[model samples]
Target chain A: MLKPLGDRILVKVDEEKEQTVGGIVLANNAKEKPQTGEVVAIGTGERTPDGKDIPMTIKKGDKVIYDKYAGSEVKYDGQDYLVMHEKDVMAIVE
Target chain B: MLKPLGDRILVKVDEEKEQTVGGIVLANNAKEKPQTGEVVAIGTGERTPDGKDIPMTIKKGDKVIYDKYAGSEVKYDGQDYLVMHEKDVMAIVE
Candidate 1:
């Protein structure tokens, strides 16, 4: 288990679901990779100039959509993860 | 003047500063493109599921560092700009 530090998050990307139209199966690569993910771990919080903690809005296990190009890729234990600042998250999916 | 909508911001990217060691000049491309920028325009806020607004943390004229891979590039008035979510801004440069 990886623990992130300070305003960072570990995201497990959601795979694009298969879609078919008129009985024709679409190639998996044809669809853009979904920017959605499940948050696994989060950092404590960002610090203000005065050293106060700026509370993070997103929480662990929150399903989130993020900027398509945000974050860095990390491979661990044969799995891939994206570590991003909480701000890279664009929206919380309903 | 483009007014961003909904928690988005326009950033003017900071150029990579030149570096020298022992009077040897380094190629500009040898250095990574800086992730810092000056905020220009900002969106009002992102809305909560219940229609409440989540005010933006980053403001116009603030110098911020963002994820290198974040944001989309646009050329406006012959100048380059990046449009990104406020969250993508990792830190404010003091």
Candidate 2:
């Protein structure tokens, strides 16, 4: 039930098994691995310089790929979610 | 004569003496030290989601303070300048 603001979106990060190699733990935060998430909520879109509201392209329930280091991590009701701007999202999974 | 694009602005970085202490030099790229520059050229402003162009707040010859690590370095006429988005600018010095 988290609501984002200003072109930001609330996302539920998909969980995946950690990758390891030869008894070495690979870093999970590398830039090469883009994260996927399900959009839970969206903001009211970004405002134009003239104070006009711009509509958002991505909608709730859409799957999206985002930048590795995008968004702020927020814990809501014992669950973790990310609140990031729309620009951080690279593409929609369709 | 480099013009920025999409809410980006070109800046002429002000030259200052590098700080040195006890034969040790402090890293010039620290976040605490915000950089100041004069606005040179700016892009046509960022486009709204509906394809409308937003007007820029900063103007040419304005002295502005920007984030330490903001923008890309470029050389024009053998002088160093930064090309960065307007959001990277913290404030305009009056």
Q: Candidates' TM-scores? A: 0.49, 0.48
lDDT of 1 by residue, A1-94 (tens): 6655458888998876668889888876644554999998886686444434578888899999998888776555677778888888989997
Worst 10 residues of 2 chain A by lDDT: A27-36
TM-score of chain A of each: 0.79, 0.84
Candidate 2 Cα misplacement greater than 4 A, ranges: A20-32, B1-94
Model 2 over residues A1-94: C-alpha lDDT tens digits? Answer: 7779988999999997678899788886643555778999999889878787787767899887666788999998999999999777654554
lDDT for model 2 comes to 0.80
Judging by DockQ against the true structure, name the best candidate: 2
* Cα deviation of A74, candidate 1, in Å: 17
Best by lDDT: 2
Candidate 2 chain B minimal-lDDT segment of 10 residues: B1-10
DockQ score for candidate 2: 0.05
Candidate 1 displacement at residue A89 in angstroms? 18
Clashing pairs in 2: none
Candidate 2 lDDT tens digits, B1-94: 4445557788999987778899798887644688899998876677676766799999999999998899766555688787778889999999
What fraction of the true interface contacts does model 2 reproduce? 0.06
Worst 10 residues of 1 chain A by lDDT: A44-53
